[model samples]
Target: MPLKLYLLPILTLFIMTFSSCSKKDSGSAVKPTEEGLKVSLTNVTEASYTAAAGSTYTFQAAVTSKLPSSGVNITVKAVTDPGGVNIPQNAVAPSTSGAIAITLIGLEPLRTVLVTVVITSTSNPDNTITKTFWITNKAE
Candidate 1:
């Protein structure tokens, strides 16, 4: 009889403890979100680039980051080089803050070539941005 009485109190206490506990709304907790880098072609408007055959065009790009001083790495590549397009620097580390210069030379007359430029934060690999520019080499 006494054991039953003790067990009843203990069970009640356990139930009460659990009943008092409540779950918190996970949505209410603030989370830090990363805003990736922003990239744009400085010289060209509307991301369009054109150059005559046997001519060279310079594509100047600028990058901005939410986190300052986070060194950035840039990659400039022609989607398909048909033996006429030459990119001297495929990879570059900007000496200035997010200033990149990509020069494309059309050795011979060719069609439109898609050039892709990708910028990634050295500090955060996931923070990256890609921009594509179309280069057309028209016969002069």
Candidate 2:
């Protein structure tokens, strides 16, 4: 009985030490959530990577939430290309819940054009996300 009693105390001490060492660290900074809006271009038909002058290319713009909460109150307001490529200014989205159809005219030649799409959350108007796509306009 005396031997068993001594072993019990030793076993209890070992278990306590092991558990204390296994405790998770709480000193790390809380990482911010990466949830946000996402944008994609689709339905770009009958066009090559090189933009041809006077050629019209169409694309369907889609917006969704990486987090479900964002999908509810999102607004895609405009699409612009500052690289001298032609795009409709203040282009309206056909459907707030669906994709927006975007059109561009291959006007000036740009080695690379950055097509920027801007979207905002109505719930959080200050929160905005910009997505850019690259295209090229070829000079004849």
Q: In terms of lDDT, which candidate is strongest?
A: 1
**Superposition error at 66 for model 1 (Å):** 4.0
Expressed as tens digits, the lDDT of each residue in 71-117 for candidate 2 is: 33433222224435354444454234646676655434544555555
Q: After superposition, which runs of candidate 1 have C-alpha atoms over 4 Å from their true positions?
A: 1-35, 45-49, 81-90, 94-96
lDDT of 2 at 71: 37
> Candidate 1 lDDT, tens digit per residue, 8-121?
889999999998897867788553456777777865553666554545667687766554365677777765445545544445565347677777654345666667777777
TM-score of each: 0.58, 0.44
* Residue pairs with backbone atoms closer than 3 Å in model 2 (clashes): none
What's the lDDT for residue 80 in model 1? 41
How high is the lDDT of residue 55 in model 2?
A: 43
RMSD to native, candidate 2: 9.7
Q: Which residue segments of model 2 deviate by more than 4 Å?
A: 1-35, 43-54, 66-90, 93-95, 109-111
